[model samples]
Target: MITLLLSSHAQRIWGERIAVAVPPGTLSFLTAEEALAAEGPSAADIAFMTREVTGKSSPSHPTPELRGFDAVVEKSPNLKWLQIHPAGAERPIYRQLRARGVKVTTASGATAVTVAHSTLGAVIAINRRFPLLADAQRRHAWEPRLAERSPRDLAGQCAVIVGMGPIGRNIASLLGMLGMRTIGVRRTAEPVEPCERVVAYEQLHEVLPQADWLILCCPASPVTRGIANAAAFAAMPEGAHLINVARGEIAVEQDVIAVLQSGKLAGAYLDVFEREPLDAASPLWDLPNVLVSPHTASHSLGQNEAIFGIFLDNLARFRAGQALRNDVDNLG
Candidate 1:
């Protein structure tokens, strides 16, 4: 019997569906609280984790809790694999499992469509000044067009996407169809279609100054943490737009805010934050040149169902003892 530990209530529902889809796999459901209460380190062959399972209460960055993270790894002595619900996995819990010789995986490709749409929406919302219009429309006021910040077209713009992974590639394709010049940044300079040129990670600095729209789509790994700092923001043209749909920690929050405040960059569209529920007093809430979303770029009514579809497909691979998809071999 393969004992699978499910920590979130929502995950339990998804897991039940996956369990039924898999071949004769047994599951054990427990909340994060209950899982902690159980004594003697409950053993499991596999563990499915939500952000809650890793001690992160917010939708932003993962909480820094080595103890709780270590506790989870310690709880599953016989664990073979640990799967996270979200795409980014630079969390302490993921690292802990890596130290424990367990395999890790993420729902990386699953949320691409939702994330791509949201990121594109952010770009449009900020460029079109939707926030101001939304407030005015709420009051039943139909004001004439506001003065443009800079009459720019998303098409004919030079766009640099910082990752060539599933989500990044999807965004590149979307932008390409809109007649934008696409440049890709990948670990290797592989030939990714829909991109005019592929640059290596080392060439990020070179490409930044040329981008009219800079989109961050890289994975949240150790090497990528805080990769986009003041230098990156400063490298853009004066009125260039910035969009981040990747991990929040990938960019330094203070630097981004400082640049936005100083008008160095025309505007920023962010769906993820270094900290979530963004403090009630966060200046970003009122920043006119920025669009702040509650890390909800990857959420939709059918998200769970879509995730289950991928999970069920992988479960079939597991049953056949074949390689699984989106498997994260290294947590760090």
Candidate 2:
């Protein structure tokens, strides 16, 4: 029987569905403890892991020895696939698994719908001054005139969406449905949904100034780290709203702070941060013009189940000798 080791979070969904999906495989939930107990290489045929398990658990970072219960697939003769739960596979374990000849897949488009909706809400909230309205409510004061003070209409606005991946394309679709002019930027400038114009990365500077809204949806890779800086922000039109649903490291936090302070940008809505669990004393919390969420914009109901469904489908493909869906092809 093929052995499947499932992490706790994936246990409820993938573990349950995979049982029905892979009847020949023996599915077992391995706690961090059970995983480490094996004498030699992994006794299992396949392991489904979340990036959190690979990085957060003890003996973090999968090694050749399969030490600390974190199984190294290709390193061990018995294991074959190392399926990761998150869309981004820039972690160390991914490389280790690939080098060892183990196949890797990801849940790339699972969170697209929810993440796109959240991005839309963030864009609208920042443009409409939702924070100011909430503050007005806290004071128990009527401020009908405040809405007039900052009137930014979503319709007719030009949004430049960066990345044009699943999340970016979804954001563009939503923005388009709202009657906004959608622009997309990709590495190769391919056609994407709801985008009237798709431009290459080289044209970013030219497009930045024309955008009334800038949405960041790119993954935080080595190529995109700190891609948004002082010059990029300066290139945007004064009073433009910035929405970041992408990795915080993509933007220079200091540069964003400077722009907001100078009134060059109308506002910003940030879901991710360079430093997670944003420190209690951080000034970002007090920035009146900025709206911050604790990286929760993409979280929604049934996320675990959705992630599992993808895993189950991919697992079937693995056994059938077919190309797996959402396979990570970073090396290429």
TM values, all candidates: 0.86, 0.88
Summarize candidate 1's per-residue lDDT along 1-332 as a digit string, tens digits.
66666655655566556556655645555444455667777666776665444444564444544245447556778887766677766666667787777777788788888888887777677767677678778889986564654446777888889888888888888877778898999888888988999998788889888888889988876667787889988888887888888878888989888887887877888877787767888777877657887777788887666655666666566656777667777322
Winning candidate number (lDDT): 2
**Backbone clash count, each prediction separately:** 0, 2
TM-score computed on alpha carbons, candidate 1: 0.86
Q: Against the true structure, what is every candidate's RMSD?
A: 3.4, 3.6
The parts of candidate 1 lying over 4 Å away from their true place are: 8-16, 22-35, 51-56, 59-73, 135-150, 330-332
Q: What does the lDDT come to for candidate 1?
A: 0.74
TM-score of candidate 2 against the unseen true structure: 0.88
The TM-score leader among the candidates is 2
lDDT of 2: 0.74
